[model samples]
Every structure is written in C-alpha cells, then in structure tokens.
Target: MENRINNITYDDMKVFFINKVKELKSWPYNGKNVVIAPLPEHVTVNPDKPSMFCFTEINDDYMEFRRSAFWLVSGTVVMAFMISMMSIAYLAIAVCFFYDGSFESTLFLCFFGSFFGLYVLPMAARIAFFIPHDLPVRLNRKTQKVYIASLILHGNIFRLRPELIFQEMDWKYIEGWVLHRSVGKGTPYYGLHLVENKSGDINRLQQACLYRTGAPWSTSEMEYQINNIMSTWSYCQHFMNYLPVPDETEKDKNFVFLSNNWLFKWPEAMDKASRSSG
Candidate 1:
C-alpha cells in the first residue's frame, strides 16, 4: 500500500477529486446545489455561460465613505458659500484700493488674490468632482482573461461603455492567488495576493476589488465561510493543482493564511518554523 501511494502524483489527486465532484452532481442537496447570485446590486453573472462575469456599480463601502447625501450636498453648499464670500471680499478690497488711490496696496492685494485663487479653486473643484463611482472587474474564463475597468456614469446615469483601467491579463499572471486574512476594527479584510509565474513577483490586488464588507458573521466565521465559497470557483480549483501538498520547501512560497492573528499556528506550523529558522 505504501509503495502504491508513493506512485500517486498531484495531478492524479486533482483528477480524483474532480471526478468525485462530477459523481456527486446528481445527489440531492436540499434539492440541488444552491447557486449564489452576484453579491453587490451592480454585479451580474451570466447563468447560461459561466465564463462571463459583470460588475456595474461602485461598492457600498466606498459610497458610504463618500458620506451621506445630506452631508455631501450640504458640504458642497457650504463650500460654495465660502467661495461667494471670498469673491465679494476680493471685489471689496479692489474697490477700497482704487478709491484710496493706493496703487502699491492694490498690487499687494492682487498677488494675495492670485495665491488664494490658485489653491482654493482647485480644492473646491476636487470636492465638486469627487463622486462615488463604480469600477468593474470582468473575468472571461473561456479566454482566461480578466479586465479591470470603470463604467462612467453621466449625471448619475449608468453607461454601457467601459473605461479600461488596466489591460486584460491572462490567468497565468493572476493564478497564484493567496488570501492574506487580517482583522481590523473586529472586521475581516481578505487581501488578494497574486504571483506572476515567470517573475514570481507578488501583486496585492485592492481589497475592495475582492471582499464585500459588513457581513453579519464575526471575523473567524467569515474567514471560514469565504474559504468554502472560494473553493467552489473553477479558477481556484485549477490553481490548487499547482499547490504544495502537506509539505514543500523553497525560499519563498504562496499559501493561504486564514487566521486573523498572525501568531495563530496551523498543524504543520512547527515544522515550517523549524525549517525556516534552521
């Protein structure tokens, strides 16, 4: 038995598991396998074609961060009022200098007005232009390509054209994905880390791009639930084929560290520590 087990390879193990999944497809599971819909209101996944994924709106967290509509509108109004007052003050200053026939004072006031105009105008413009916006990440499984883009909303109306944020990347660039779990303010933040196969360089994808915050579960529970869900993804299944089983040794490696605490140890933590420390 030991000799036979030693002959099995990682690819063999994956094939076994994949076949097992196929066998279980006909089994009753509260009727059938429950399909999860796209999470955010703006996201839509094609049911007929598993390869196509769509996201249309900004994240709720980002919208909330932009503040409530009342505050946003009121704050802008207040800035507008400040600008009006500044304009009136500048006009009054100009009038005073001209009436007093003080050319030197007028020159000094003009310099000061230019300085304030340069800074304040830009600040106001930024506040006015900064609105909560949506960025979409599309995955085309058939093509093995993923696109990160933004859908420009004109006057708060959704548009069809996508503003591509980055050129499409093949699965090879995003294949070695690892979830770096951390807890902040009692909430779990799963950071996506992808490694390039050729260069072995790790890229940390934006947290908002991956997780939807404000779930009811505590940090630990959420981590477990997310891990289970991620395992169902076809991409994740393919990535697993390249993973190290039980033990592997190399200077650098990619693996999921699900614990909220960095000090939390896995079953093989001691072995890994000894190997690295030695």
Candidate 2:
C-alpha cells in the first residue's frame, strides 16, 4: 500500500478520487468533477460577444477573512453598547429606590438589567452580525480583473459585494480579471455576482450565473440570464483578459509586467528580481 501511494502522481490521485465518487453514485459537492476546457491559445476579436473576456470564481480565504472581521467589529460594538446601557439602567433604579424607597422594585430592575446585558443583548447582536453583507471575488493571476459572486456563509445569509480588498500595491501588481462591471451615471462602483458551472458537461458548456445586490439600476436578474447564454461561446482564455482600471478608459496602457523568474520559490538572491526589473 505504501509503495502504491508513493507511485501515485497528483493528477492520478485526482482521477482516483473521482472514480471512487462515481462508484458511490453521489454527486460531488460543488460539482468538483466538472472539467473545464484548457485556456485558449490565441486571442480572437469577436464583435458579437461584448462580455467574452469576463469570467469569475470565488476566493475562499478572502471571504473567510471578511466574515471574521465583520463579526469582530459588530460583536465588540454591540457588547460595549449593551454593557453601558445596563450600567445606566442600574443607576436609574438605584435613584428610584433612594426616592420612593421601593427596595423590591429596585432589586427587580437590577436583576433584569443584568440579564439583558449578559444574555439578550449578546444573542441579538450575534444574530445581527451573522447576516450576510459581502460576496467573494477571485482574481486570475494572468488578468488583473475582479469577479463577483454571491457567497453563502455556512449555508446561511448571502453576501453581495464583489470588491477586491487587496492592498494597492498587490492590486497594481496582481494579474487577473474581475468578474463584475462598474455601473453608475458618471462613476459607478463595480457589481459582483456569484456563478456556478453546470454538471456532467465536461466542456463547461453549461453555466449558471446568479446576481443578488441591494443596489438598483444595476444589472437585473433577467440580464444575467441572458448574459450567461452568451458565456457558452466564450473561450476560457478570453476570461483571462484582465486589463487594469486605467486601461479601461486610457489609450496608452503602461503595465508592470511579471517576469518568469518570479514564478517559483527562490533563495534570497533570487528574490531581488522583483526590484531588479519592471
């Protein structure tokens, strides 16, 4: 068994797991078996397909970080507010006891106030924090574009924003296409949507694109339905044409090109390539 495991290549291990799932007759979660075509080789200029160059997927790690940040910020704010409110209530009840001399009423108020701060407020704040607010964006290393999709956290609440939260330096240097388009009268913020590939379609011939956003005047659900029909004819490489934001409007595009030397793990001397060349 040890020898057999050692001989199995990464590609073979993938095939092995796929075959095991097929034998069990269960649909692979998130359709992991779905095979997409290889990235296209040559660029094709097709006037018919305006959205031919855009494709989007989810970045799991970034989404997780955003969710955690939201919870921390919301939880801390709510806890602090509740504690302050309870303290104020306690003081009010004590003053009432001093004036009317109603010891039982004051004691009751103190007990209820403590319970509200300790249990009720925290539970309510947690529930509010758990509500979804942001979506996931995946950046393709070859194209500096962003893609947006609705993300369900733990199978609950749907996130909607598709903005990339990477630092300015990372955004400027990163290669990939963002999936969402900016929409506004003058300057529009980009809109992100969640998308999923269809099952058993080895060529990735089928796809389902879903957009859920709070903003009006954005692309409607029906627009997405129409857009996905066109996505079928788009080549995978076209999805990789992610030009930076300035290129979206400017004519002369000056981009920081990545070098082959920067592709792999390297020693301290090799790490200097990031600065040696543009």
RMSD of each: 21.6, 15.0
Kindly report which residue stretches of model 2 are placed more than 4 angstroms away from their true locations once superposed. 1-101, 124-136, 143-193, 201-211, 215-239, 242-278
| 148-239 per-residue lDDT for model 2 (tens digits) | 32222232122122121221112222211112223334222121211222232233211112221222243574365334323422322243
Q: Write the per-residue lDDT of candidate 1 for residues 1-278, one digit (tens) a residue.
A: 23122243334333433332233221111212222222211112222222101112212111000111111113332453466457557756766665454777677777766665665544433323332222234343334444442222112111112121233445444432223223334543332222223342212222112222223356576665455334323223232233211211221221111111232222353223222312
Worst 10 residues of 2 by lDDT: 60-69
Candidate 1 least-lDDT 10 residues? 60-69
lDDT of residue 102 for candidate 1: 76
TM-score to native of every candidate shown: 0.31, 0.29
Candidate 2 yields a Cα-based lDDT of 0.30
Clashes per candidate (backbone, < 3 Å): 0, 17
